[model samples]
Target chain A: MNPATHRHPASYRDPAGFVFEEDGILYRQIHPRYQPSYEQLKQSGLYDRLVSEKLLIPHEEISQPNTADAFRIIRPQRIRPVIPPFCWTYNMLLDAAIATLRIQTIALQHGMILKDAHPSNIQFIGASPILIDTLSFETWIKTKPWIAYRQYCESFLLPLVIGHHGVPDSPKLLRAWPGGIPLETGRTMLPLRSKLSLHWLLHLHLHARQSRQGDTPKSSSTGFSSGQMKNLIHSLKLGTTRCHAGNKHSGWTNYEQQVSARGQYTSHKLAVIQKESAALSGIDTILDLGSNTGNYSNALRNISEKIIQLESDPQTANALYEKNKTAGDQNSLSLCLNVEDLLPAGCDHGLIPSLKSDLVLCLGLLHHLTYRNYIPLPDVLNLLAQLTNKYLWIEYIDPTDPLIREHFNPERVEQRLIDLETFEKQLETLFTTRYHTQLADSSRRLYLCSKK
Target chain B: MIHLLYLDPGNGSYLAQVIIASILGVVFYFRNLLYVVRDFFYRLLGKKDRSADS
Candidate 1:
């Protein structure tokens, strides 16, 4: 078996089709069982309408089947910087919920409905969320209630409401319950005030009780009408919109202001970055470390195809993500992540190295890793080397710098760095410097290095 | 509807769903009825289809 044509771990649950990559190209193989629904999706014009509106990821049917059991094969454009549900901001989660509702509405208009409403079925390209699961649609039966209703509530609505209530760790709940936060679990966790709201009472509280009692409304007459489904969708949209994270201050939210306060230093740093980035070539993806407000990555927007901005603080990362999304900068993806605990080996169900970059940009982050995080310089260099495939743009901060001093004790700082020569010697083990320059009137030195 | 009621298990959940569906069905039926009634009068007065004209 060719390793390149292996099936994705998350794609196995859906028996209609499974996603596979062949020679770096993603393809979906539709099973023979899904032929009827697939034909209905196309014949009903839902597929064309959705593709035209960019609500669904468009695919081109392959002429030749890749495997013998395949009823049909299709090639879909790979969306980069794939993020998990837990990392999404409150607003992003709401956007996802709205997107799911929109898909359901459109599906119903075409005499179809979503078979499942899991967050994993959706992917964000910039701020816009697109449904990636083509097989989620099935011909709507008036007698059958919305089978995915409970799923929608648990996966999208519950998480958004939890986040809106000032719980920042709402997304983490997804890790524990991959199917979604259970209805009973959410009902218990939500505050008493939430129970008073009609939307919450009907969807969360009553729904949970019904589920616990093993009450399945399966009979034809007991099934809800299309009108009721529409009403439910409307209520869900309004409920999701009302759930807000409310303004809460965090440390890195005002990082751009601090940088601007050092007037000359900011401009000098920007100029140095612009000059160095302009000289680089053959770089498509960039992994930016400590991308506070995405200042450096945003500067390289024209040159890089995709920029994955990794920031430790959630507020700062979310602010940058929202800004990029609003501007429709499709190439930039901001994520809240600490470099100290980069990518866990097997956390995302065997989807290893979620984001890989041709080039890495580590600007004003060395001190944070070495001083604050207590990561040795050699270990830091090794991790950066592993993440980047080709080039690295790293910044070395002098011990004399105020930011470095603030993060580290004076004695520890002295012991760690010792001298500039020692730091350069450590970096030489993994990467060779291509371009090195000291910024004007600043103790920072920027190096454009390439893996040896 | 009677057959459906018989087939369903004697559970309150199905009954609740039936009630909710009935209410929504009534509202939807009336909402469409108003438009149908309006169209009938318009045609009776020898007027063009208001929906098509719009």
Candidate 2:
């Protein structure tokens, strides 16, 4: 509703095109520099084919007759709910990676390639991954090796191998190196035995060596002919097919094997909230923030009509989606999303975004915001309060909690920590704290609040 | 294992299994309660989570 508060970085990648929102509808404005590529994308019929097939988001070309600065602008068909990679379950991420590859192969056929390869560029729409960046296409370079290879590896390959293969902390690997993980860094993380295999050897080992060769004929004369292009597509299709839901690690199956509530702490905390939530009548939907596998969603099954669990971990979200989808619980939907960049759908403009939920749960999620630049905790509470018209069930992890400290680095107990009073002051202004309970040790607290 | 491995090669084969499983996972993601019950038993019996292994 507030313009200053709503503006998102128009996907900060290229220095050229910029994304802007007008009346809640998102439109991308391309400068004169990218005119050639934009022309090629439309004239080549790639735009029509992709949009019709639903591989790419559909956009409308806007031309105003009276304006002097007639810049080429496109308004893409917006997604109802925009989710981030962190919120995806493992399978969802895999699907996204596959979709990106498929899009890349299709672009190559049209003499174009994706200039950037950030996972955030892709999002899930109804169990299928959709490439959201309509501007990623550019005229292909026949002589050069795929320039976006390293990024693909980092944004797509690294997370997949690390999450499904043995590395449980693969997601952290990307978090540490926002720019695609360096090849050498990836090589170091992989076990010595993996280097002997061809896929790892050529892609990871030799690829890193080639990168260091700096300007050593980065482009080869080799180009994919019509037949060879088909083969490449087939190869990518095969690669995506191999990457599937069951490809989880032992740790993933028993994710809490290393971490539990250290006694009956989790159960106690959850039970308290359940008792309070069950008492509320005429409530239909409950949004479970940071729902780590739908455990909390189970608690409100009695009184709540539908429980939507939002998780940041791609793998966890995928697993939760699969679990809930299987039970045919139409009332329950799990989506991967980042709470930091919360946007309300259905703006004043033509942007038909997803409808905002009634209730919101921010359990065990606020601490992660500390890692980024100062996201004033009050601002976050304010945003949550703004989006919801009903009750809010929230949780705060005690500063003394070891897991909280470990997950968040530098252990800035001073700059980041939000005491009970500070947090209460932020929320009490917008809503009154109706019920509060200390879950498990003194680390976890659950509060049920009503709108003022 | 014999039926799957013999039909495909390279990473392509991995995807073939994955696509099959994905379709099945979507179809079965909500319908059959018996699958989860069976999977729970497998998990208890030390059957590794091979859902993504394809």
DockQ of 2: 0.02
lDDT of 2 by residue, A302-376 (tens): 887667676655557667777775675656666655565463331111211242456777776677665343477
TM-score of chain B of 1: 0.47
Instruction: Report lDDT (Cα) of residue A414, candidate 1.
Output: 69
Per-residue lDDT over A323-441 for candidate 1, one digit per residue giving the tens place of the 0 to 100 score:
89878898887766667766333243222256668889888888877877677888788888878888998888888997877757887776676357877998899999998888776
Tell me the DockQ of each model, to 2 decimals.
Answer: 0.08, 0.02
TM-score of 2: 0.59
DockQ score, prediction 1: 0.08
Best by DockQ: 1
Highest TM-score: give the candidate number.
1
